[model samples]
Target: MALPTLDDPFYYLANFHTVLDWLGSRYADLLSAEERDFIAAFEALPRASRALLVRMVMRKGVDFRASRLRYAEIGDTRAAAAPLIAAGWVETDAELELAALFTLATKGELAADLAPWLAELGLSRSAGKAAWCAALAAESPAPRALPAWLPSLDDTHYRLTVDALGERFRLMFFGNLRQQWSEFVLADLGIYRFESVSLAASSRAFSRRDELEAYHHLHRCRERFDADEPLADLLAEIPREPFDNPWLERRRGRLLYKFAYRSERQGELRQALALYHDSAAPEARLRRIRVLERLARFDEAWALARCAENAPVSAAETQALGRIVPRLRRKLGLPRGAAAAPAEPERIMLTLPRSGWVEGAVAAHLSRDQAPVIYVENTLINALFGLLCWEAIFAPLPGAFFHPFHSGPADLFDEDFHARRQALFAACLAALERGDYADIVRRRFRDKHGIQSPFVAWGALDERTLALALTCIPARHLRLWFERLLGDIRANRAGMPDLIQFWPDEARYRMIEVKGPGDRLQDNQKRWLAFCAEHAMPVSVCYVSWDEGGDERERQDAQGDEGQPQGAVIEDAGAPPNSAAGGNPA
Candidate 1:
């Protein structure tokens, strides 16, 4: 049977199952041991019970009403939830109630929504706590007395114990815990001190709050990093507290890597190199190599490239070294007699009016010709590459210690590595499989359910478009192409063609880069164009120039050598004057 359309409820249903399958299989490692155990227990239940459990778990808040579970397909809701309730995952009849004083405190915000009810009760309209208390005393339901297991406190509230807090932390750490009850509870407590006076007075009152405090520190560091703080200041002031966990280590490494990255961007190569040495992030190492080259330390860069090429941790790293080595050899004035060249390079380069003009014109032209064209540039390609090497991109490694923010998929380097080559190959193969690519892509982006991936914003393409792309691009070719593209995922992920034209029926696609008036190709764009040319990937650079409209004054200016547009469009023609072989100097 065919898949359902995007608007169909069955589509969401099927996609939900797909997410579950991915969680159960691909992301099993992300869950804690306890979470895995809970999943195992869930699987062991009867089908209806399992469904009900899933519904409960996926539900928004902690205290859902019994009426909310009355879904027709899950049979008797109470019977279905029997196992969960017995397992202490759910509780009933021991409901908590708000104090009269608390109600009086929040009566203003509540009164707006309950205006009709308030008016029906003939309560005072005055905005005073005394009036609110008086009205509540007359009409409010009596607070229930505490059961034997509960504390008999009337004026005070309860707080989560350290163990309970830790449990919640674990859930948040694993992406399962949510800020549901805390959102309302914190908002309701105006200025109350609920914990014991003794605990509050003690120096170790919040000793067990180390994990939470560490996470808070990590967040502060992230903010400072985002604000572009100096590497020296950041190194000195960033959190030194250690959680001794793999996740925290990864997070700390990622933060340090960010500092190094900022240094590199600011042209402080020596300082950046020093910072890179402290990180195990692949991007840092790759940057170090590039910085060495920029500093004209070719021999050092060459040595590092040789070592990385021999033992790459990820496919992206290996691919980067492959490109770097060749370029380094060229930079060192090595001969290229043995390397094959295009017999007759027939790639095209055209002159348009402006950079913006090139994109719109090319996109419109391609769309008019029955081709689905998208201005993906970096977002789509990077996202695809990221997913294909997610494991390597987020793999934890030893680094100079900083604090607790375990690097997740946010960091894409191994010190200088990109992705594990073998795993990348596997991912590409999986991507080519029928239904797998769509499922994986949808699941990753949480399409139609959660946060959608901005990458897949390509127009006129959905799961159908991706399926067609896999058929055309194929796993093997896609693997080879992406491997060559990852010279440095950090750098190569950008400067891609501004437009992509895909012909679904023909199963063909071409990338087009746009250049405006007086604009020239950047180093990265030249490298990408050269790579495409070498591998027979259809790509072009459209140089946009202002149209003169045959005006005499404009014609005079246009006649000048500087004003005249240069470059030829090769349409099944012989090699142009400056072919791809001679074009890219990067």
Candidate 2:
């Protein structure tokens, strides 16, 4: 039975258990050993303060989190949260919702599980979905919690821990990336390439898409991406210029440092000393001191460094090292001067734009009668309008209407194809007539189920329009796009045209391309056009010109010259000064 949920302010205070333990440990030095004392003799904390610490602890602890589907299926909802609401613990935030959902997954019903009942007897009024979705939207991705069942959390377990956090949350959640990232999984998880999605509900930014993009980016490392690892520029998101693939270059220096540092962390002095012997760089040597001082091995770390040919270093640099350095010096030998150091590698994040011109709510036209700038600008415009009109009206409505690339003869009757097509055509015209893309989508489509916003409008369209539109998009613009998507620059690549020269002063690199052509596509071009049609990142196309470029012989000559290069694919540069993609380089 679903109980009426009263808003619970105390619910606003739930947190991970680790946070509380950390805070409690800070006062361990002040507290006297109580092996001989009775618990009754100790003073108790106030309820308010006790609650605060409890909440903090819950937020920080990584143990007890489950990765099973049972946990994910037991999603938090207004009804499921009713128990917390009843207990005055139902404030609306991610911690509270996740906590409540977690309780239901393990303990029992914190609130009525809402999905079944809502599906059976539809919910016309649900502040619950809204509130819970809001909560999920704000959650930063937390460190992966290990199952209590793991023997010991090693690096493999550490990797799985991150995986489990992904499995646990039903709806999207924010990831708090403040903790250091694991190096082993870095390339596979696209940790460096930035991304963001515009949340429909709150104007508030959520880091979920950022994490998802990073994850997808990393997964590309197998097979085709092997050894073609992203450069540090791809990891341009890292502090200091990351050394391309540090694993491939300075792996030993960093790995040894990690081993020595971890040894110090575990208080294994002999092991740490052995690991430091593996270091080759000055940076790695200094890192040994930092770890030792942190572990109160100051005398050894200091002595070890001095007995070598290491060059003299700055006092400021020494003082700026680890906090444990001075503390270790005091404990292991005579203490030296101390200087407060701000947190290094501060919490810096790379946030990609949520929405822009390519994905923006705007309209521009292309031509279909004749392609290549050799044709007049007016010709390009009328042709594009004709191409789309023919595409929208002539193409098979649903099955035949599918984007030619992503799907084949398989799975023809899926409802998504028709629904999306109707929505795309409707949304495009709505924006075209209104001049306000966002307003049109929000007014006509957002609540309607499929098309919602422009972010999804392009891909959500049926296969036919998508495939044809991609084919219609000129080749040159597509080339530049393929380049930007890569983590590394292509070797033996020709210098790309700087179409940055043609874009409007206001639009950096955002306008959608208009591929115009009055003719049918040849075989080689079709292969590429198919890829774009299938992926649908953010683009639309229309045939611009049909009859202005060089002959088939010239095209073949261009492709086959001795120094011309093989496996070459022609693509658009970008929007051009005269026509859309500035008509071929002729």
lDDT of 2 by residue, 474-575 (tens): 333333333221211111011221011122222212122323223343322232233333343222232333222336544664568654322222243333
Report residue 347 deviation for candidate 2 (angstroms). 29
State, as a TM-score between 0 and 1, how close model 2 is to the true structure. Answer: 0.18
Alpha carbon lDDT of each predicted model: 0.51, 0.31
Clashes of each: 29, 63
**Per-residue lDDT value at 554 in model 1:** 49
